[model samples]
Target: MGSEKQGFIWLSGLLFLNIFVLSTADVHYYEFSLQESPFTKLCSTKIILTLNGSFPGPEIRVRRGDTVFVNVHNQGNHAVSLKWEGVKGSIDGSNELIQPGRNFTYKIELKDEIGTLRWHATSAWAAATVHGAFVILPVATEDYPFPAPTSDQTIILGEWFREELTEANQTITPGSADAYTINGHPGETYGCSNDTTFEMQVDYEGLYLVGVINAVANETMVFDIENHRLTIVGQNGTYTNRSFTNSLTLAPGQVIDVLLLPNQNVGHYYITARSSSGTHITNGILRYTTTTTSF
Candidate 1:
């Protein structure tokens, strides 16, 4: 994908993409510092656990058959464990809890599996914000089953809480999210967020691969661009027969790869994400290269 930036989780659906060139498979190394960071959203500021202080943590990209070793240092107050979704369960202690001030190294074997996958804290409380993308490129002899995109982007779908969700665990039931986000912003739909809204621009009639991950704690969200349609091309770790639809609905921790064509009139389009029930809503902007008007 082009850029997932460093902020934003997918509000409803991820909307764009690309893949990495393959090379000889080898071992890759990474480090993660799990700590608490404060963020202000939906008119409230709260401390949440984050990896290296970034929400939607850093993305891990690799080729199939490569091995990965991630060194995780737990600096936050809580114990946590991480899992590479869609892959075999955590390996070499990656699934074991990293207690506060302790460290652990994870070994991952990226076998023949391909496509977009995700990683997140296995703890219910810490999972609220600790996660990122895992992309596996096919080896030297393989290519995507569909058209290569002219451009690429990633959308991370996630929920936001005004209070520390972990703190709410003391209650009989945890609270629902206050707002959904795309790329970390609520997209001008909530209080104090006009300037923080997330947006994406596209070339008229350009073909785009949109990588999307639903990191929401416990909600299924629907994503779409007003008056536009997308073709579902891949999901989890498998590419499938192309299916066309206007919106994407994803459950928590689910991921999907879709192709989008901005073939409508040149202007700003609302990239809308909402609960499947349509009760809660948020948005991002999808504008054309020469866009000058909005409705």
Candidate 2:
């Protein structure tokens, strides 16, 4: 009999495409949300800001020879300015400032480094919300010399505000303390029944390779999967934490990759992530089914 431990079942629906597998040449341009929050929690915060909404927006996982384009659309009340000067490759540092209801495009070619990275607004007014992750995976054709997952999912942790961003920034006094949020809101949303709505969803079941990117707050997240095993991968895109277990501190701009093997049986499960602050953010789902049967 094959050892269950030896069989790592992966969900490929979320997997990168073959064209992106090891292709030395590819081009992709992402759209940035200057108006709407990429996350749903903002629905409760009732706060609308200049940020994209997702803690770290979508992970741009690509291989070598990829050209990335970012089209930023300004939807907020304040004018948006992005100074890329501090960004490693940004020579001038200042990309064009996007005005309200306007858009701008940022283009760059990928080098050979494979790791996680972030793109944030240089503007003081925008940095509070305009942040996301940029990931460059090793060339696809190259053999990954590790126990990798068959499928993957992403979890983003950030703060949400219902109030207008302009109002929040103006009210925050220069010397006063600033509140850090996870997913979008603070601890949880208040409800009349005392059942404050808080927390995000994590997928349960099957084999899942998960990536959690914290964009705004510094959090030590504990991911609990019911009856499953987990392994930690790359951190900060450079620090390698291989095959380990324990809730680790993930500061802003950090990414954690873990593999999970769920309890046996073809079913569904929820992957849960909770911040040390007791804040809940994003959620992902996993479904298991026999190959002999259609999903």
Q: Note the Cα lDDT for every prediction shown.
A: 0.79, 0.53
Lowest-sum lDDT 10-residue window in model 1: 13-22
> Across residues 1-295, which tens digit of lDDT does each residue of candidate 2 receive?
3555344323242244434543557788777767654333433343445455554344566654467777777787767665332134552325556788887777766654445556566554356566665666666566544555566665555544444456336332221213334333343333223222333333334456666666553455555454456677665545265776745457545677666655445565444455556544333344555423348
The superposed Cα distance between candidate 1 and the true structure at residue 124, in angstroms, equals 1.4
On the 0 to 100 scale, the lDDT of residue 268 in model 2 is 50
lDDT of prediction 1: 0.79
| Residue 189 displacement in candidate 2 (angstroms) | 8.4
lDDT of 1 by residue, 1-295 (tens): 3346423345222221222322467789999999989888877788989999987788888877788899999999888899888885447776578889999998897766677899998876677788888987666565778887787778888777776667445321223677788878877877674327778989987888888888876677888989999999889987889999989999867899999988888889899888775556888999888533567
Worst 10 residues of 2 by lDDT: 171-180
Q: Any runs in candidate 2 off by more than 4 Å, and if so which?
A: 1-23, 36-47, 50-61, 81-88, 91-96, 122-129, 167-206, 218-222, 239-241, 264-270, 277-295
